[model samples]
Target chain A: MKTLDCLGRRCPVPVIELAKALPNLEVGDLIEVLSDDPASANDIPAWCRMRGQGFEGGSAPSYLVRRLS
Target chain B: MSYGQSVPPTTNLDSASGLPLHPAAREALLTAVDEGWADPSRLYASARRARQLLDGSRAAVASVLGARPEEITFTSSGTSALYEGVRGLASARARVGRHVVHSAVEHSAVLHAVASLDTSVVGVQRSGAVVASEFAAAVREDTAFGCLLAASHEVGTLQPVADVAERVGSVPLLVDACQLVGRAAVPAGWSVLAASARKWGGPTGVGVLAVRTGVRFAPGWPEDEHQHGRWPGPPPLPLLLASAVALEAAVMESAQEDVRLRGLVDRIRAAVATIPDVEVVGDPVSRLPHLVTFSCLYVDGESLVRALDAEGFEVSSGSSCTSSSLEPSHVLVAMGVLSHGNIRVSLSRTTTADDVDRFLGVLPGIVADLRAQAGV
Candidate 1:
């Protein structure tokens, strides 16, 4: 499990954060993202889909997802 | 005048139409035409049925705009409603005072209407906001009415309505809620409100105008008994229903969608900021969640918008689209910011993180290409 802090970051930063975290871990690893920008709620899920990963929903202030090979 | 229908051969990022219906509005439009095409202003049973649909739409729109059903009058477009609203207010408030005060950042509709009136437009700071204190200081005791947008359409900056209203003393506030209605909750204090249905995922040709309970509105036309004779036009039942449905849908889904759009905007902001010579306009925290605008120095905005369009992205530009005119956007110019190579990206409920990523992935290359071509 790799936890990345993307809080208070705007567009492309959260995506960049996920991209950096993904290459370091094995397949099926859980990654957590904390964001304050409202758009990230939708952007992250869409990012996961584009990357061929799965997004489990999260409560506000945080989001959880898993990497798939 | 006939509206032309030509489809561009690329992905559209235009927030004006919102993300191309996503099955709900598209499906609704197909059936709504069949079920709601009857003339709503007639006296027959079928007309009464159409009237019911119109009434339902009114209630729904009123609910979202924070006004009563009796106060709302539907018009063909937001421009028409604003023309009517300003004209009506000018007539009604003329006795009190003939002067109208508006923000420097208003839409062309509002600005055009004010141009025809005895009006004064208050300017903004470098941050794209019309200061409440400056606006109040500009108003005289003889000033009758005022108008301002809750959020600007071009730069996406919000106005200080409640504070401005407090400073204005007793003048009525007309809020152009076109950009902010569905995206955020409106602050209480406006006496009149207007918004375009298309801005929030509804069909075009439908606009909502809400006049507060106590404000006086004298219709400009010699009219009969429709919409209190305030606006004199036949209402489109199908479009109204579609507008109502879309507004309600936005309200239901806004909390989640807003958060999502803000995130994408933030990401774009961060990426764009890292590039030197890029100036991102608008207030970073106090603006709309789904919209962000940036102006690149030493580049033509139209060329940038066109380049992005060619690359499968549909975005809007502050650059004048009319032919042979080289005037920059009044919004950017007023804020004393860069005027060329400016683009405004807005998101809708249908927009996904993938769309933002695709936009981000393609945008840097497009800007770099345009810069290389311009020899910047």
Candidate 2:
């Protein structure tokens, strides 16, 4: 599990942080992002889909995802 | 003549709010209703009472803008405030220079003013933010002023105002904070700042212009005596009171609302991304909390907006601002991005979670419907 803390952050901050962190993850690795912005709930999942990765689950203030092969 | 009336939906999922007016703000407006009619500048006793309300309002607005009371002047609208500020700077600094520099993605008001200026404009990347170094390179020794917005109104991409200030060096920096003030704090070192009360929470027809002391300008060209003759005539006291109250309300709730709205905008980007042939515009990470924008390929933005409106959504498109001319959004066009079917969702402090969920629920379906109808 690789973690990127983006709590209290807004758009593109969480998005940018995740983009930077994505490369470090191996196949099937987990990337967790903590954020309070409502958009992150949808943004991370969409980002994962765009990159062909898997987004697991998250509540407001916390988001978790898995990187896929 | 016999057709039945079709009313619009009260819940605007496409808007930043479920309700047009936030409860607290509405209450504030009501509790202080009496002050709404008083004239702050007149010599009558009632005017004195109005003056108290006006002073407090000015102080409240000044607090959010990070400027002194003497520096702040109220205007009728955001567009007018920006025009006046840009023009004032251009006129005041003409002795020192005749050239002006502004980001390519500036608001229409700024762009129009720039068009009116005898100066050059520096274009920006598709991200809608000017390259700071490139902007600095564009400035000449005879540069009269430099103008930069706190953020792009259409795309919601934030500009590095402080960095731009540094780039301006000795030149005056006219900062358009219309989309930024009350949501994000103004960056320090601006020579002049402008904003609209409506963009935050105040009523329309109230704009703010804050000029730092000692900046000289030609006041007679389009002079108003309102703000030290920089603007003319007596100010609108009721609207100013409303503006101040709205500013205070926004300041109080901004942190929490920003968090909520950011999430909402992010969700919008995510949900919209699921649809085929959709491209979300702007810097994904570096945007305002309460705004998000996107475009659909090969679709007309006006039609998309009308479709959304028909589906109980009250949203706007950057395309509509250019509706009459049928030109694409300058913000999107400047970014060299797609301009078709562009829509901008801007939130108010009154926005709700349910409201966003409703929008997310309706948006993809609306897009799908439009796509099907367009046969794309």
Candidate 3:
């Protein structure tokens, strides 16, 4: 599992960073995004849904996403 | 005379702010300034004459708004009218509740007025419109005031004001009709309404607030009894008369201009959709006839606006990341649309088909260049 620290970053930046980092990881690999942006709570899941990735729900400030394709 | 036929097109196209003074409105302003230069509140001969002119202007404004003369009060600007209207309505209904419910897409004036209150923000649909059911659900028994725009200034999506008013029965619905008043008929059943003069090609420094008869409202502060206690200061007589004249003219021209601008907007919508990675936001059919908004993926919004401006097409953008203000447009965010690279094109009565064609001709290349520079 790779942890992408996005603390203190705003929307589109955190999401865009996550998208760029996702290609580096192989399928079935897990990534956890640590973000303080309140928008990330909704945006991360929305991005995952749009991109056909697995969004495992997270505790506050940390969203765990898995590469599916 | 029609604005399109009488006024020649300018070299630079301005579709950003609807502040251009109409020719008839300008003439009215000049006439009023010469004739109405007295305090109408006094009882002297000149004051009596000014009072008559003021009353006549008020009646003219009231006639176009479907409001009574006593119900309409002119204010300094549209924002001030909204501030006074929202605060007054909230204060009057304090016995019932202190909570205010408004859609996330409401104009800044409404949002700022409700900021200090216990606000319950209703979300909007992806089309930049508030879902009537969702808005109704957000209204609690404690909701003292309800606010909904007649139409969005940014995306031009018309809200279901009548439906929401019906659902939130008994709550005072303060409809900010700034964008819709002169463009279309103000829908019935709103308890309070506000509009700006400059939005309808009238002069600046004048706004109108109409509180329906029987709606309980309290002024925000203690002041001399002017404007039925809604606005305290002496009103601008000339500007008030000009506002009435402009509104009457704009309302008369709106129906014909609506059809023409709808065709121009349809052209922009169809042409923009053909561009790769462009998402046109707002309801296609149930939207303002002269406005359209679209977002380009991976392109900076400010860059796009500037590039369009450089090509003689003035437009406005609402992207969060493109400017100093990092907060995204609450309307776009609530709608879950792309928040970056967003551009809003709002047409006025003077906008011509050639102006729109010029904009459309240069838009695709502008977006492609921006995207290419961004390496997206």
Give each prediction's DockQ, rounded to 2 decimals.
0.01, 0.02, 0.21
Residue by residue across B180-293, what tens digits does model 1's lDDT show? Answer: 877899867888888888888888887887888888888766686666677675666677788888888888889998888889889989988766567788999888888889
Quote the B-chain TM-score, candidate 1: 0.91
| Cα lDDT tens digits for candidate 2, B271-309 | 888877678888888878888888765455777777777
Taking the tens digit of each residue's C-alpha lDDT, what string does model 3 give over A1-69?
A: 899998987665666678778999999999999988655665677567657788998954899999999
Error of 2 at B299 (Å): 1.8
Better of 1 and 2 by TM-score: 1
Ranking by lDDT: 3, 1, 2
Q: Candidate 3, TM-score vs. the true structure?
A: 0.88
What is candidate 1's CA lDDT for residue A45?
Answer: 68
Q: Comparing candidate 1 with candidate 2, which one achieves the higher DockQ?
A: 2
- Across B1-376, the per-residue lDDT of candidate 3 in tens digits comes to 5565443334343343566788898998999898888898887988887898899989988887788999998999889989999988988999888998899999988898889999988888888788888888888888898999998988888999999899888888999988887887788778999999998888999998899999999976556756766887789998988888898898889889889889988998999999986788899988877789987765667788788777767777777655466667877778877766789888887777787887888889998897666545
Model 1 Cα shift for residue A38 (angstroms)? 38
Per-model TM-score, in order, reads 0.78, 0.78, 0.88
Ranking by TM-score: 3, 1, 2
Evaluate fnat for each of the predicted models and list the values in order: 0.00, 0.00, 0.00
Native A-B contact fraction in model 2: 0.00
Interface RMSD of each: 13.9, 13.0, 3.3
Docking class of 1: incorrect
